[model samples]
Target: MAVNRDKKEPVIEVQDICKTYFMPGGMSQSVLKHVSFDVMPGEFVAIMGHSGSGKSTLMNILGCLDRPTSGVYKLAGKSVSDKTDAELAEIRGREIGFVFQNFNLLMKRTIADNVSLPLIYQGVSEAERHERAVQMLHKVQLNGYEDRLPTQISGGMQQRVAIARALINNPKIIFADEPTGNLDSKTSDEIMDLFTALNKQGITIVLVTHEDDVADYAERMIKIGDGRKVYDGLRAEYQKDEE
Candidate 1:
């Protein structure tokens, strides 16, 4: 299905976002400072920064795992910055998928069970959940592994299982944070290739990474420096500028 990009609203919108943590003795630290960006439907964007540059904090906000101290955040055209925790959880479950650096699969569960875990929260029937899990596993090319455990698979395969689980909900967007951090170079390339294929299918992707090679997989790059957005533009252009 082709997405009409011009007619669709942005999937993510952040304006003048800021986050601060108050410390003991009347001190505070600002992690994000007036950062702003928009991610259109079907767009693939990579957020990059060194440690302590606030990229992780920004990702947490973007993924609805945390809220900014100040500023507006709109997800799929709805203001979410002020939403209650329950509301944010509902939104996260319904509209967003997450792929983390660690696979985050249950070690004791079957691959199919791990993939279908989200559906249990939605009160889906076990049979239907299993069916959908099978379908998602197929989508990730993990056929015939549904009955296996995460420990039985390679790191790359475990990541594939995680991706399949993310897709089981059919979210409008996926937030991947250092998705290839645990893999070897070749495996990392394979995982990035999978992400690229998913992006081509019109699923919006927001990835956070510090590695230039991983960021290269995205078309656009948003670079942060010391709590502020330092650059935002074509990934290739950013590389050229660096060169």
Candidate 2:
């Protein structure tokens, strides 16, 4: 489905966001400084930065895992920055899907069980959870491996399981942090292809990575440096600027 860019408002909006940590000595460290951006529905954006560049802090805020110390964040037009922890958890469960670099799967659980976890929290029936898990596994092209453990699969396959788990909740947005970090180059390409296909299906995706090749898959790129946004524009423009 082609995204109706003209009619849809931004799915994510961050305004003058900042995150700070205060030490016992009355000293403070700022991680993100006045970071602001907007992500439209069905857009695929990459957040690129080196270590200590505040990309992780921005990701945490975007994912609802952590609230910004100061700023306004609107997800699907609902203000979330000031929400209580319980409310944030609910929002995360309902609207956001997260894919981590580590593939954070339970080693003892079957792939099907892993994917069904999110639904379990939402109190989905056992039969329905299994059914939805199976469907998502199929979507990730892992049709018959639902019964296997994460350790029984290859690194790439485990990542696919993670992606399947992320999608099982039918979230409006997906936040992937270095999703291809653990895979070989060929497998990374395959995973990126899967993400691309999902984006084409109208899912908004925000991926965080330091690799230019990985970021190239995104339609837009936002680069950060020293705890602030350094660039935000079309991928073509970012590439031209790099050149």
lDDT leader? 1
Prediction 2 global C-alpha lDDT = 0.92
Total clashes, candidate 1?
0
Please report, in order, the local distance difference test score of every candidate based on alpha carbons.
Answer: 0.93, 0.92
Off by over 4 Å in 1: 1-5, 240-243
Per-residue lDDT tens digits for candidate 2, residues 123-207, read: 9999999999999999999999989999999999999999999998789899999999988889999999999999999899999
Expressed as tens digits, the lDDT of each residue in 1-243 for candidate 1 is 998856877889999999998999999999999999999998889998888999889988998999999999999999998899999999989998999999999999999999999999999999999999999999889999999999999999999999999998899999998999999999999999999999999899999998889999999999999999999999988854561
Pairs with steric clashes in candidate 2: none
Task: Per model, state how many residue pairs clash.
Answer: 0, 0
